[model samples]
Target: GCFWHHHDCYLFKVPATRTAFWLDKIAKNVARDRRDIGRLAEQGWRVLVVWECALRGRKKLNDDELGERLEEWICGGGPCAQIDTQGIGVLDVTSPPYRM
Candidate 1:
């Protein structure tokens, strides 16, 4: 059920209406995610936080490529990792160390 735990899974983009409220809400959600991740780490459970932006948009990796990367990570020995977009290539959170 760890994967079902609520975290910053949604990409909270500020809408045209209620921009201020949305910003505040997203800030709180991000803070909560950090706390939860820290707690999981303390319990020796690594967490991977792949942002929605990385999985969508014009620069996202192809589905096949994404699946390959995920498969590699799951089968590998890394404790934690995240796949994100950076420029043209995908950013490896564990290797270069990406924050949020």
Candidate 2:
């Protein structure tokens, strides 16, 4: 992404299968991310974060089964295609999130 004054910028999100970012729990809001950004800016750095919902919306447009496909994509299986979740939430065993 383009940065302020034409500097380069990069964005990261809550990573799946990431060991480094695991916290005891995610806050009700993004207080953690905001705090990190403040710390980085204090050190003369720029940090960018892309929210899960934003990427999910874009992924939905490209993949027929954005839900299951997103799991495969996250694991480098391929560009997510689609899977029929049948309206099951995270607890559904058949869901990719539960299986993977």
Candidate 3:
């Protein structure tokens, strides 16, 4: 989940051992995700990134709320968006120190 994707959320944590390897691997995963999203978007495919934090956590949204959000985004016809513990919307992927 968030760990492999290197999401800046509560669920992601760099391993104490082999920290360098984990970080490198996670970084590569993040890069690949970005690249894949870009490719899909270029092909006119809508991309929705529902972060794990939004599904399970103290701040997780209820089923109805989550469903409503998904419905809105799907019907709204947005190119790309993300749902996290903070809320549902597009995040600045280019920004450093990414957060949910």
Candidate 4:
């Protein structure tokens, strides 16, 4: 979820206590995800990230909508894509570099 992945979304909030520790842990997870995605792309694998918010929140798409969106992505052919409550778009693999 966004909380664990530290996604910049409505669901993620740094904890009031042990803030630094939580931030560090989340940062590591984010880094690992980026690394893995990068490696897969390097090996010629297309990736699609469907964030939880897209499925469970107030702004979620209906089943048929989500299905059609996924189908389009699968057929359209792209290096990477992301689907969230905000809608579908190319995955932003770029950001300020993360340190391990």
Q: Point to the candidate with the largest TM-score.
A: 4
Question: Using lDDT as the measure, which candidate wins?
Answer: 3
TM-scores for every candidate against the unseen true structure: 0.61, 0.28, 0.88, 0.89
lDDT of each: 0.52, 0.32, 0.79, 0.78
Clashes of 4: 0
| Candidates arranged by lDDT, highest first | 3, 4, 1, 2
Per-residue lDDT over 1-100 for candidate 3, one digit per residue giving the tens place of the 0 to 100 score: 7788877888888899999999888888887888888888889998898888889978787898889889988899478888877778874456523443
Candidate 1: count of backbone clashes, pairs at least 3 residues apart or interchain: 0
Question: Which order, best to worst by TM-score?
Answer: 4, 3, 1, 2
Clashes of each: 0, 2, 0, 0
User: What is the Cα-based lDDT of residue 92 in candidate 2?
Assistant: 20
- Residue-by-residue lDDT tens digits, candidate 2, 21-93: 3322333123444455556656865333322332343232234444444554445442112232221122122
Candidate 4 to truth, TM: 0.89
* Residue 15 CA displacement from its true place in model 2, Å: 22
C-alpha positional error of residue 3 in candidate 4 after TM-score superposition, expressed in Å: 0.9
Report the Cα lDDT for residue 55, model 1.
76
Model 2, position 30: C-alpha lDDT score: 36
